[model samples]
Target: MNRWFMTLLASLGLLLIVSGCSTKKDEAPKDPKAAAYDFSNEKSFVVYGEGIAPVHTVSPAQAIVLAKRAAITDGYRQLGEKLYGVKINSSETVKDAMIRDSRITAQVNALIKDAAITDATFKDGLYSIRMEITMSARRWHELFSY
Candidate 1:
């Protein structure tokens, strides 16, 4: 009995030591290509847009087609908005200082090139599209006016 107890205690001690040493060391994350890029300005980003199916479509296929077209246009608009910005115009006509009428309008105008539709889906009368665009340093500078 004495010898068995000593062997069991030894086995438990070895297990504890192995488990304690297996803990991860405190170290910074390892980046394989940390110093590869000196000046990287090329990037790609994605945008998403959704459109509701029109009520007056001639057929189900036509509904999906129209919704997909609208979704694609919306995606381009969103991408333009992200790259540039939305222009807003607001007016308030206060007749006799009584706040009679107010109106607000927003618009975005941009020419997007080479934007690819990455994914598109139509479900439950709603169509959505994911568009991606890649901009190199030259394109970036041109758009940013730098």
Candidate 2:
């Protein structure tokens, strides 16, 4: 009888272990941005941007509002970076040269204004925004045609 009881207990333990191992609850949370858009195609590029706001000495609502604004601005900046590549300059370059002389930056900023803000989140006193801009082949040509 004791042998049968031990066998039953061992079987139950094995069953529990197998069940736990097969469960999917341990999987990492999927990115919210990826869920909204398909990223596998080569035609579109996906980028993420984040902004942080402090909760100290501020109301919760105020913190959230500030963080969200910061996050949206950050998203626009990120989109601009993608549309217009960053310029690397030597130390000898003038401090205001790029801002004063470059029209590319202004053009990119104009494009970024039209980008879609796909996702925004406020968590742990930090706000994150994700912007998606589609650049199709025709659009690419049109941009360069200007």
Q: Give one digit per residue, the lDDT tens place, for model 2 in 1-146.
A: 99999999999999999998998974644986544354333345456667778658468787788888888877777766776756654333345555334323233333553577788887787888777777665565556444
The candidate maximizing lDDT is 1
lDDT of 1 by residue, 22-139 (tens): 8776653366444233225676879998988999978998989889889998999999899878999999998886988999999998888999998888899999999999977566
Query: Which window of ten consecutive residues has the lowest lDDT sum in model 2?
Result: 101-110
Model 2 earns a TM-score of 0.51
Q: Candidate 1: minimum summed lDDT over ten consecutive residues — where?
A: 32-41
TM-score, per-candidate, Cα-based: 0.69, 0.51
Candidate 2 lDDT for residue 138:
54
lDDT comparing candidate 1 with the true structure = 0.85
